[model samples]
Target chain A: SQTIHQWPATLVQPVGSPLSLECTVEGTSNPNLYWYRQAAGRGLQLLFYSVGIGQISSEVPQNLSASRPQDRQFILSSKKLLLSDSGFYLCAWSVLKGGGYTFGSGTRLTVV
Target chain B: TQLLEQSPQFLSIQEGENLTVYCNSSSVFSSLQWYRQEPGEGPVLLVTVVTGGEVKKLKRLTFQFGDARKDSSLHITAAQPGDTGLYLCAGADTGRRALTFGSGTRLQVQP
Candidate 1:
């Protein structure tokens, strides 16, 4: 069975501080990875997706960027955090060309 | 860009009641999916509707895809407290890799 893991269940950081969130998947190889952010109990906003290693597609141009360093390792980063950057971040993985996805537990970041 | 809109953004109902959530879109989709999310967790894929006019039932939950493949609905019979969560519909746009998510419907079933 495939499982996803996301780090730092919750974080509190000051404005302008650097941020890094990591996600990894096991039991699958070459899976498509995605990063999504959700507002308070609302829909998810696609941030970035990667079809393969070193390939990232950004959906919304904002203060965040994503990178897939390995086949199953994806990282979301920001050089400078904004108040608006604080939200629930979720990482998901799916088989290539498949519609359904498996998501991680998510990380809640609060920009103080 | 394709978009999906959900109705009844928030619903509070008593357990054992029946409720339905709808997801509508003007653009056609290749496939549609329904997801349920709990607080502080990720959305879990509940079902996927592919063929138009397709209906699939999972226990008390029934999902239907419109004949035109432009809309879908989820109906829960005898809703339970365990059914309380955020319901989201996502569509696979034609020729697009990423799924377009609906605004979402928050359902609360009080016991």
Candidate 2:
């Protein structure tokens, strides 16, 4: 069975600080990865997605960026965080053949 | 861009009651999926409907895809407190690799 792992399940960052969240999937190769953010009392908002290593697509323009450094490793980063950047960030993976997404536990970011 | 709209954005009911959530879209889809997300957790897949007018059952949950392939519904029979969560509907279009998700419906089943 495949499993997804995310680091720093919860984090508190100061405004204007840098941010980096990591996501890794085991038992799957060449899977498409996605980054999503959910604000309090709101639905998910897609931030970025990658089809392969070094290939990334931005769904919405904001303070965050995503990268696929390896076949199973994805990273979401920001040079400087904003107060609006505070939200629950999620990482998901899916096969190329329209498979349903498998999501990681998610990282709750609080930018104060 | 495809858009999915879900009705009854927030629903609260007692356990053992029945309820239904609807997802509607103007664009046709190749497949539709239902997901449930608990507080502080990512959404988990509950069911997927492919063919037009398809219906699938999982214990107390029943999912139905519209005949036009542009809408879907989730019906919970004898709901339990454990069913309290955010319900989301996502659609996969033909030749598309990504899915467009609905805004979501938050269901609160009180014991």
In order of appearance, the predictions have TM-scores of 0.98, 0.96
lDDT of 1 by residue, A6-112 (tens): 98899999999999999999999999999999999999998999999999999999989999989999999999999999999999999955479889999999998
Q: Which predicted model would earn the best TM-score?
A: 1
Query: Across residues B1-111, which tens digit of lDDT does each residue of candidate 2 receive?
Result: 788999899999999999999999999999999999998889999998999999999999999999999999999999999999999999988766677889999999999
Report the TM-score of the second chain of model 1 against its true counterpart. 0.98
lDDT of 1 at A10: 96
| Residue pairs in candidate 1 whose N, alpha carbon or C atoms collide under 3 angstroms | none
True contacts kept of each: 0.67, 0.49
